[model samples]
Target: MTTDTLVMPSVTAPPHSHRLRQVLHDSGYALLSLPVGVLFFVVVVTGLAAGIGTVVIWVGLAVLALTLLAARGSATLERAQLPTVLGRPVPRPAYLPGEGGPVRRLLTPLRDPQSWLDALHAVLRLPLAVLAFSVTVTFWAIALGGITYGLWDWALPQEGNEDLFELLGFDGGTSLRIVGYTLIGLLAAAVLPFAVRAVAVLQAQLGRVLLTSRAATQAELGRLSRGRDAAVAAEAVALRRLERDIHDGPQQHLVRLGMDLSRAQRQLDRDPSAARTTLAGAGVLAREALEELRALSRGIAPPVLADRGLAAVLAALAARSPVPVELAVDLPGERLAPATENTAYFVVSEALANVAKHSGADVCRVEVGLVGDVLRVVVEDDGTGGAVLVPGHGLAGLADRLRAVDGVLTVDNPRGGPTRTVAELPWA
Candidate 1:
């Protein structure tokens, strides 16, 4: 035989209107749900005691080389049951501390607050959900049955009407009918809705208490994570820049210098004048290598960019580039963090370089302005199509550099050309 399981859709009131009413109703119901609260409190406190005791027992057993499977198994079930009833997501119990030895498992429970809370939540959930669910269900059943019975009695208008209302545990004749009908209306309009809302609010509160971090703590963690991401990106860019500088600059020059020396040796036997010319070429190559190394060092976190700030550095880079650059800078010299300023300078420099080398654009525009807490830099070029993220290129390095400072780089290279690279760096 084939069986089909029916899935019921969730019924929740609208967030603004119905939800708000539900919240208020739940707040008032919290006190009325006193028995449930007390029961939950007892269960939670007891579970905490048991869990702590169990950990101690496990440690003692581990010292004797006795199996601890039973203790661990029990704790696992206790914690798992919490999420089922409370409707809050809680983690399951993993291996206790000190599985490697007696000291670890014993100390593990002490170190973790969540472990203790999990045990406590599990122990308390059953009592709380049971008491609260029971009271809510009972009240609803009475209100519904009373109203329904009374209405049937009133409509029938016979000797059996009195018996039906009485059986429903209501007052005599008209009085019974009125009370039952009134209760039905009130339950439908207020009581039932309030009960469901109260349960949800309580569940949310418990979930937050046992699961999610506090608002302030979460905000702090988010900030730290962003800062870390930026730092990592910056380091990555620095490494790439070092690699490129070595490959294109000093390394290539040194190889050529070596070849020139070999040529000089060959010429020295036949023609001394030719040998002198080769030596002169090697000298020139050595000087070129030194200049390339210096340039690479400067790119690896330049002191000039740090001391003078971003605007000056960018202006210098733009003035020196092969392409003509029009810089419109509006940032206050003292308002930027050293990191933020350095990253911005690189973004503009890299973008302009791309324009000169690849974009085939004649003229480029660079603008730096502060918008509230963030510094916005725009580099636009009327160049050929296709500016994409190519690994190891200036554009990719620029993106990494900006990200290191909690900044973002957006390259809008539409099909028709005219690529716009906008970099936003957050002020410290």
Candidate 2:
């Protein structure tokens, strides 16, 4: 990674789908529902207290306390559900670490802004529930009552003895009576849907605003946190890889080359042909050492990947992979933001490398495509399948690399076979 690009490990799972929208709305409704239930329970308990006569005031205060207790629990449940339903990762309220006293824990939630907002949201729920109930229940009652009056004239007993027919200047029969009820029914029918719909609209807006975090803000926070972690992980991996390369690869080759040179020097006094053979072996060792050094350099972030962009780099990687690899690049020819390009390159490279070394696959497929506003890369190999992400391994390193760029990797290592690694990179 370049000095300008900071790599960090992040939690970059994509948000849940549209199916979660209904889940969130229902959760909001549930959060808002507690106040009405509390209200009902309080009213009943207060009425019971009135029957007892002496303890009505004390009982009312007790009911109030119970309602608040219910509200607090409701808020806690709402906070927990918001992450799953809304796909917003809000931290839960934590108790004070050492002191487990009631006063300290109560003060802790009061001090947190998120907890306060949640409490405020819970408090707002009661009035909203009342308003929603009034609008919905009242409209239905009026509409159904009007319909009943129109259809069943006997149900309008108050209008029976009245000269409503004469008041409308009509014969005192069914027609005048029918028309009055019919007109009321029609008016009520039209207004009812409008009223119910209006309430639902307003409630949805209010609840959505109070409950869900904006997707963009959540994404940015996730990106930054993941980036920091991946950076640390990547730095550590790079250092370890460099150390291994020096110790096992180039250092061994250099040692052999030195031994070869020493042998050739001793043979030069007596047997010129033997000395020539040893010199040839030393030359081959020097070439092998050079190749190992080149491989080490390539491992450290390839210069071609930086200069030519991810498409070209990936195309080259596919060409060189051990298996007959099918490379498909849907990325634009133009370069992306450098960090994003690097992360994508590392993912594809590591995936393909795994295929070559471990996966006994004949052919590997690598795809890079842009879906919606995000870039997706998938690499699949039809090989014996049991790929585990051990710590400090290549795939793990690649996972960390993708995280730095607000991307994620999903690996499928089913017991049956064929491991598939899919990576998603956000365009921004």
Candidate 3:
């Protein structure tokens, strides 16, 4: 079977009412852009010209600074209006931080590249806004006029007039006239949505490129950097937890095993019976230590996961869980990306470990399935709930692990009841 696309799926047509509503929104944005754009253009251009004409005077410096400030205000307002067209919040661009003396602070805007870009956008958007407004108004008039032709057609005097049909070598009958106008209206109406959408997109895209593109890129980079940092922190926490567990569990058991063997050796000459009993206890201790090590080792990368697949590894986990586990997996026959499978395995392992250790529940449920381009892993337990993602805690580590690969984690656990952990990962 083929895999589905994992990001930015193809756009599909919405319901008619929704489409019409969106068209109205687009029209409103189009109508508003012209006035807003013109205002910005006039303010920035006038200020810049006046400032340049008098730059020799010290007053020119202040004029230029204030002009940049006016441009920024216009840009901010436009940014706020952008969501109507873009359907996403526009992030404010980071300006140069003001520092040092009053003169230095006043001059900060001149040095900032974003401020210049903002000013440039203010000057350029006026033409685009005019174009969009012209197209939108013209099409809207044609569509509305033609669609309502029948209602208003009889009001016009037709007694001595040669209609357009007559000029075109056809009968100038009223019925034909109305029909023709209505058909023209219908044609314009058919193209109205696309026209509005095009204008809105044009305006929104230009605003985005000029205003927020760089800031958005920087934000994304910051997010990735944070995720990487979280991954490193999670690794550190996991290693520490592993070390503590080993020291407490297997290390202690090994010490006991060693002491048992030593005691048995001393008892062998005094009493063979006691020596045999001590040896038996030592055998049990060895077995327990081996099992504890194996259990801890499973959380790390297990070879069976790579050798067999996710299903086999999940089955093994279910079989070995301390709390009875109910596992359900719905996946394609082929293997997923190694990173995806590894994360899923770790999620299940960690979640189950939490349930067994803290949940006090009789049973836990684990489910893994592919939904569109996302892999969803869910673990639910019917016990005392109140699960939280405290920093340095297991849940937080799990969250970091998921975030490292652009995944998300959510937990739903109220005070007194069941706990649910859900992780969504991009299907690589």
lDDT of 1 at 82: 35
Worst 10 residues of 3 by lDDT: 1-10
Residue lDDT tens for model 3, 50-97:
988999987777888889999899788778877867777877767889
Candidate 1 lDDT over 330-407, as tens digits, reads: 977475876777677777767876788788887889999999989999998888846787765667667766765667
In model 1, which range of ten residues has the least summed lDDT? 1-10
Question: Root-mean-square deviation of each candidate, in angstroms?
Answer: 10.1, 9.9, 6.4
lDDT (CA) for every model shown? Answer: 0.64, 0.66, 0.86
Q: Write down the TM-score for model 2.
A: 0.67
Query: Which candidate achieves the best TM-score against the true structure?
Result: 3
Worst 10 residues of 2 by lDDT: 1-10
For lDDT, the strongest prediction is 3
Task: Quote each prediction's TM-score.
Answer: 0.58, 0.67, 0.73
Candidate 1 regions exceeding 4 Å error are 1-39, 51-111, 117-211, 214-237, 258-272, 283-287, 333-335, 390-394
Which residue pairs collide, candidate 3? none
Local lDDT at 66 for model 3: 87
